[model samples]
Target: MATYNKRGYKPKTQKEKEEVVETDSATAEVFSSLDEGANKTEEWVSENQNIILIVVGVLVAIALGSWAYQVFRVEPRAEEALVESAQANEYYLQAVNATGEQQDSLYNMALEDSNGKYGLIKIAENYSGTPSGNIANYQAGMAYLNLGGANYQNAIDYLTAYDGDGSILEAYAAGGIGDALVQVDQKADAVSYYLKAADIQSNEFTTPKYLLKAAQAALDTGDNSTAVSSLERIEEEYPDAPEASTAKVLLAQAQIAD
Candidate 1:
């Protein structure tokens, strides 16, 4: 129950206490003098409570107005975006359902969903700035790759431009580049991207697969020494990975080849 002064950690002396009492008495006298000019808290509050209510109401209105405005602009745009994206997804699915050369029709449909709305390519081009557009690039890249595994160059191009926040998706893109390179006989390049994909560390399933692919690329390029090293890494680092079987087999093969 001890109060300290500003200068030191001690209570006020009697003189300071007396000074505080005098200050309170003087302040009381000043408040009394102002009583006749205004009804004080009671009158001021009564007179201005409606004004206060109106001010608060205006503030609430502003907050709600801002929220409504943002929703009006953002929601409709996002909805339109979803519509276009869904159409693209539908086209992709259609392509999946189709077989033989008829799949081109499905690809075109995806690009020109009966509504003449933005196709996947255009969605990728226009909304290239948005998350949806980035996904469009991913889908389009995959479509191209699937349609022409020989078009690995183009697949690598689009996959390179892809910007996904997901580590797994990014890893997939990297692996796609490796696959495309391998298709073109760029085994060394394939190994690089495959190694990068395997290093993504996003999921259990994809990492081992990529690591195996990297090791294989090394082997195919007559780098059995490096291939052996990579296989050993997968065996030791990802023993539980699905690629473990392949890694062991590759390790044995590399040892034999070496």
Candidate 2:
């Protein structure tokens, strides 16, 4: 028997033919498994179509509702709060520059005006989540503080409610609370808040000022250690500050007391 050979063509052995048959069977099984899985998935989806649609609808509704709330409710309220608090802010600015009876009158107007406009107090209470409303809390607190006397507690309340989390105003609010606490004779609490104010933001103006206040408050509370430490920080870190000379004297006094 004679075999005719073709160019670049090899005949498969018995084992090779068996391997090819096995490979084809494996590929068919894989495709069959995939088809079965797809069919099961299709059946499952058909059975749960209502539940799936409900979940998707709920998610869409939640997203739309949140967007609507921000656009409609929150934005409008913020604008309204800004407008309402403008007159109060003007009064507060005037009070800051004025003296004696006029100052008191202007501060009172900032808190509550009889001119049919919402004052700082009302704006803070009504538009709580808005930026302007948050600012109104700080303004109202300062107004009460400037008014002095029994209004110190009201200052404390409003300042405590203020949310100036990440700004320099946070330090200012803390210092204002410390001031109010000092006026109310809560020396230890005042010391705590003064230190907090100094720690919140480390700037040339506020840092040394609050550190000096902290040192003074600590001295008043018989916390000679804190007084010395705070005074020393100001003397070392803020030598060029306006409070530096005062801090030096306080440091000397604190060391002598210690």
Candidate 3:
């Protein structure tokens, strides 16, 4: 038929009319598919309304419970732990920084504060799940270690209980346990712990230091194989570390002993 164009009135060609019809059909098909999809979605929703509602209710309950737990339990406990830890932390610092008998005295005070409300042992015992408590475990372990005598086992126990983020503190805890084990005559386990400390985060400083310790422990146990291995690891992985030179000398000695 005839069609009016922007330029002028003109008769529609058969091809042009066919093209227009095809375009309309394609548009209609797209709309039909969309409508079908919408209808199916509505049908599914209607069919599974109870299930969907139950799922949503469960999700909402979980969210609310999580929020309530954090607010009512976690936050308050953390705050109290932090407050107690502040005093404990001061004592711990004093213990670590002091000298001679004063250091040991401060360490004892930190382990068993006079007030009894803020001490590493108390915090670790009472608030074992708190962050401050976790730190308390490490502090207590180190305190026991510094006290030396019969506290080596205590150091091992408390340090073994510590769980820290993958930080230098974790390395220190592992290394502390290794030292304690060595003192307790657990040569083999001490070697294992020293290697663990060196590998935990694998930094140039802690790794090489612990590796050197591992080598020494191995040598002490007459395990020339492990001594060589640890020393070689230090030379290969931490060649520029301060322990590297020492590690090389140790490796030479261990080789001769082997």
Candidate 4:
């Protein structure tokens, strides 16, 4: 027998031949490992198939339950709350315009259920997560504040719970809380809330009004620095506001106190 090499071809070296064998073995081991891992994964999944199915079923049930709750319960309740609050809101607005005993009577009507209609208090309590319910809280707080006396505590409770959507209502709610605190002689707390109201959403109407209130509350609490700052802000930012004139007088007083 005889062997011949082709032109420009060389026979394999021992080291090269060994390296080729090692490379092929390494490739085969990788493929074998992958196959083994796949088989184990399949076995594990088969063993836990029932548990996996139950988990998926529970997830689907939760998603459907949330959807049904929003559609059937929350949406209808929100609409109902809005409708129920209409009469109470009207009474509240009328109370704002009325005076003396008439105003108190109207505010009482708005606060309590009457003629089978849900009042602001009931609306706020029942539909707590809804938008109309939230507005009911604000209205109820204002009504209690107007009613005065021991109702100041109720006003504080309701106004403190109100969460406004970055609107003017937020400033009004803070200012309302401040008013209730002042009535209760919590002057220091009242000053902070008044300042919060003035800062929540700055505008000519609410900003100057709350700033002036904050200054007075601060002065009452002997917080001369806060009083001075609030009054100065009003003088500089809201010179044309009705509160500005009062703010100037308070500013001089606060400076003297400081």
lDDT of 4 by residue, 107-202 (tens): 999999998999998999998999989988898999999899999999988988899977899899999999999998898999989999998999
Best by TM-score: 2
Please give the range of 10 consecutive residues that has the lowest summed lDDT in model 4: 1-10
| lDDT score, candidate 1, position 16 | 69
125-230, model 3: which lDDT tens digit per residue? 9888889889999999999999999999999999999997787899999999999999889988999999999888988889999999999999999999999999
What lDDT tens digits, residue by residue, belong to model 2 across residues 20-99? 56766998999999999999999999999999999999999999999999999999988988888889889999998999
Off by over 4 Å in 3: 1-37, 236-245
True-structure RMSD, every candidate: 8.9, 5.2, 4.2, 5.8
lDDT of 3 at 23: 65
- Report the lDDT tens digits of candidate 1 across residue range 1-258: 224334454336887677667766998989887885567777888989999999999999999999997688656666667777987898888897888877877876775546767778888777655667777877777777777745566677778889865568899998988888888889998998888887776456787788788888999998898788878988887899878988998899999998
Cα RMSD for predicted model 3 = 4.2
lDDT of 3: 0.91
